[model samples]
Target chain A: MTGRDRKLTRFLRIAAFSIGMIFVLLGVLRGEHLEVFAKAVRICLECIGIG
Target chain B: MSGMHRDRVETKDRPGLHERFRLLIQLASAALVNGYAAGFAGCKIFTGTSKMVCLPVLNCYSCPGALGACPIGSLQAVEGGAKHNISFYVLGTLMLFGVLFGRLICGFLCPFGLVQDLLGRIPARKLHVPEKIDKPLRYLKYVILAVLVILLPMLAVNQFGIAPPYFCKYICPAGTLEGGIPHLLMNESLRKTAGALWNWKLGILILVILGSVFVPRFFCRYLCPLGAFYSLFNRFSLFRMDLDKSKCVDCKSCENVCPMAVKVTEHINSPECIRCGKCKAVCPVDAISSRFETDMLTRNVAVKKVD
Candidate 1:
């Protein structure tokens, strides 16, 4: 029973920590890859047939 | 049968003061957003848009006379301005909002969310998006943020010698529809020169609006870069929902009320949650409540002792 409680608690901790960090990482990534992303957009737009 | 019905009636309690307060919060938030939109649209800030503090909510920066800047829009603008060798005042402003309120902006005060709520209220039946499709579609907003929001500006500078907000251009039904088309219709001068672009934007707005009638906050789920930014703050944000299992009556009222389909008992702080407070209001045994930073620590201690 105690082991179950500890495991559940550990799961919550990991879930909470990982979820929060995902956003922080995504936010950072957004600002980081501006140049590569911009070029990709142009090529993709042309492929699909619009500017 | 009648005796049993009256017995059930007596057992079912009426709503209390807390319920009233919750309803009041919803009414006030919706009114504030709608009133501001009407006022901004009218340029009658004294009456219409005057109540919108613009600090707690997201509003487009290029909006005709918008008093405040959208955090995401500002971020992109600042990034673009920097690439063009200009000061990133816009991005700086966005960072300040992100740090200050976090995702509380989404919970308490986005006019677009209010629009979704109103559309959801329409008499038409609510449509359920299948989990298979909904799950995958949720990621589209991020891709939009990555490519349309981030990538386009970077490329335009590197290759084309021009940079513009691509998300706003291609995908943002908000700016194109919310701020652009409506304002132009009101201004006769702007209408005369209206071209294919205006028509295209109007068509996009109409399609999104129709989709919204069937889908709950489809734009927030799919398109809004601002929502994308605020979601980053969901965890560290001081505001939170607390569950007290001590009451031990897992009635599941909170889970049933959540519009976002969040497993409220499990994912109390999910970014998908807009914090509408409906769950807290509906709990029959008062199992859920709102918590702020330090107070939540005390509650957690209390929760530890519950069993």
Candidate 2:
């Protein structure tokens, strides 16, 4: 609520924004590479009597 | 007297199988990954599928016909090369979700987290780490990121004296167990050629999985680089805790319900807080709410009558 607190919150928000961008970038770049992961998921499902 | 007890039993029973449904979702998600592997007879890429979701959990990436890659594995892949450039697309996608969901992924989305939860169900008395020990030890994941994820690959020399994914090779329990184990298990070629390095990775994965059952999310709290990344978004994340001190009775109910041991009052936006909504669920005064960024903070006001 005060100036100092607002500054700190703003700093935290900016920091979070930067970090979030990093994760989103990584996820999109590699989204297509997960064919192997998806395949593994299918096999696991079959083992558990789930289609 | 017995009538009151009967009513309590009726209310506590959940009326049906909500718990069962959650268990089914957890199991089904885990199963799908393993099932994909079984169908392909080995790990193979799916060329036909266009839509892929980066599952919000650690899944065995080596399983065959995997429609999409594990985020951790993909991150390593991007950094494994000499160029050392991160895939902005992947980073953006993960950031979008992290800002929105925070660590709710750990409680509600992660397959591995679910596994740990299920394993903790065993009647063995849980060992608790005192706050003194638990608080500082949570930084281990950041260490893993800086050392295992960033430094190692950046430093390693390759065929032409370049670099490789050191995190994947040395520290990532997720990559070792997820992408490495299942493929190695089913693929005769990989099993025969497996070396001491493989043993080392297996040892680490076992330690991580077993450790998580003892301490809530030991991996997520400590060694999960991905979790470390999401944690950074905890405060400003679209989904996050909002505390109205006006009505907070300060009874510590939310603290008791939190699995990650976050003090709901002392620090509402700790990087370690996963924004799981569990605290909101158990708040007796309904003072804690995970209101989204856009919603006019539609806070649930406590409407109790007082004399």
Candidate 3:
């Protein structure tokens, strides 16, 4: 690959990583993790074919 | 040495130490994530604090021994909740994993993927799916992701304003194998309640089991939404496959061993590649290699020539 292509690829990777981290922080602020936790702690009867 | 002679030599050494190391990692990952032995014995799912975190793979949250939430399940739960909101937490977690490792998780970390890998070891005649059908069928997982995982959970709601996790309730063979069958085996009352839905899930599980026995990584190739999600980041993920065009002799050894049917010579970083290192292990000239993108930036670029 050319030097220009390499630079572009690197830029894209860094941009994606930053975006992912930002979303994670936003999700934490919104307390979505707590929703996930509350749901996961249960037996999830539908998941086990009971529902 | 000629390419043909090198090919024969490498074929004899196929699935060398790389594969063995990968298997060790796969086993360790499967064990570490499902470490709650007490949950299994007591016939209960883990309700520990660790359940708050989402695992990167397709493990069922309802599995008695699971310590963390499955990303897809958590996404569906939040999406189908009374609020019917999208789950930023699960989506962000999945994106983080995807950007970091891509489908490398499918190759090494997923408990369900491990099951399919083990099943592929059975001594049977492997069936080769024709390109005419296989190419299109590979899109089925993405459809399932968009529909069962994202669409149905968001749009289809009951009178109470809650929606069922369509993927888990209707399609997830992993849930049936790891959570449903085990729970049914442990609780007699649960077994008594088994209806057509449970039977349907059981049938899907059997089909997946049988499919894996004949075709390697059948679920990952054609049915795993998690794999499809991870694949989106494969091209830009930190983990990457690099092929040295200068050293390659067009031997096609890597293509033959690839379980995902990735055209490694043409597209070394194809999204379909699971990065199982089978191609790397079988390469006669050590033309195929893997590295993190950070490593590429820091290393002496002049010493490496990759395409």
Candidate 4:
């Protein structure tokens, strides 16, 4: 691959990583982590095929 | 045996140090995620602060010993909630894992993937899926991700404004093996409620077990939504495989030993590649190499500009 192509790929990877971090921050701000915790702590009946 | 088949058998007979190290990593990851042994005795799941986080792998949150939530399940839960919200946390966590390692999680950290790999070692005759069929079947996981994990949970709600985690409820054999069976075995009340859905999941679990024995990574290749999601970032993930064309002898040993059946020589960074390093391990000439993209970037920065 050319240097230009490598640079573009690197840029994209950095962008993706940045976007992911931003989303994680937003999710935390939205209290989605607590929602996840609430759902996970319970016995998910559907997960065990009871629901 | 055919040449490729013979090479595969030889590789199996003499696993390299890399293989042993990978096995150790897989075991450690499995143990770390499912470390609550006391939960199993009490027939209950972990309900600690750890559940606030999502695991990068396909481990079931409902598994008695699981300390963290499964990303896919968490996604579905948020999507299927009464408010119909999307789970940014799960999505971001998955994206981070995909960008960093891609499906290397599948090859090394996923408990279900480890199970399949172990079953594939049963010494029974393995089945080779024809390229025509295998190629089409590979797309099935993407469809499952789209429909069961995403669409159904978002769209199909009940009278109470809640939709089910379609994949975990109806399909995921991992859920059956990790959560369903163990819960039923320990909790008589749960067993009393077991019905057709439980039976269906058990059947799927059986099929997955049999399929894994006959064909390595059967679920990963055609069913795992998590693997499908991670595969999207494989081409540009920080972790990468580089094949030095000058040193390669076209021996096809790497291809033969690849559990994912990736066309390594033609496309070293194919999305299907799990970054397992089997290809690198089996390359007779040391032509194949693995590195993080950051390493290459650092080297390029140090070198004089030639371009």
TM-scores for all candidates?
0.67, 0.74, 0.93, 0.92
Candidate achieving the largest DockQ = 3
Q: How accurate is candidate 4 locally (lDDT)?
A: 0.88
Per-residue lDDT tens digits for candidate 2, residues B39-74, read: 356354343343144545555444453445566654
Instruction: Give candidate 2 misplaced runs (Cα > 4 Å).
Output: A1-51, B1-56, B159-162, B295-307
Q: Model 1, residue A37: displacement in angstroms?
A: 26
TM-score of 2: 0.74
Estimate the overall C-alpha local distance difference test score of candidate 2. 0.60
Candidate 2's displacement at residue B174, Å, is: 3.0
Q: Is candidate 1 or candidate 3 better by TM-score?
A: 3
Which clashing pairs does model 3 show?
none
DockQ leaderboard ranking = 3, 4, 2, 1
The digit string of per-residue lDDT tens for model 1 on B122-149 reads 7786678888988888777777777766
* Interface Cα RMSD in Å, per prediction: 11.8, 9.1, 1.8, 3.0
Instruction: Give per-residue lDDT, candidate 4, residue A47.
Output: 92
Greater lDDT among 1 and 3 belongs to 3
Model 4 chain B: weakest 10-residue lDDT segment is B298-307
Chain B, per-candidate TM-score: 0.75, 0.79, 0.93, 0.92
Segments in model 1 whose C-alpha atoms lie over 4 Å from true places: A1-51, B1-56, B82-102, B158-161, B295-307
True contacts kept of each: 0.00, 0.26, 0.67, 0.73
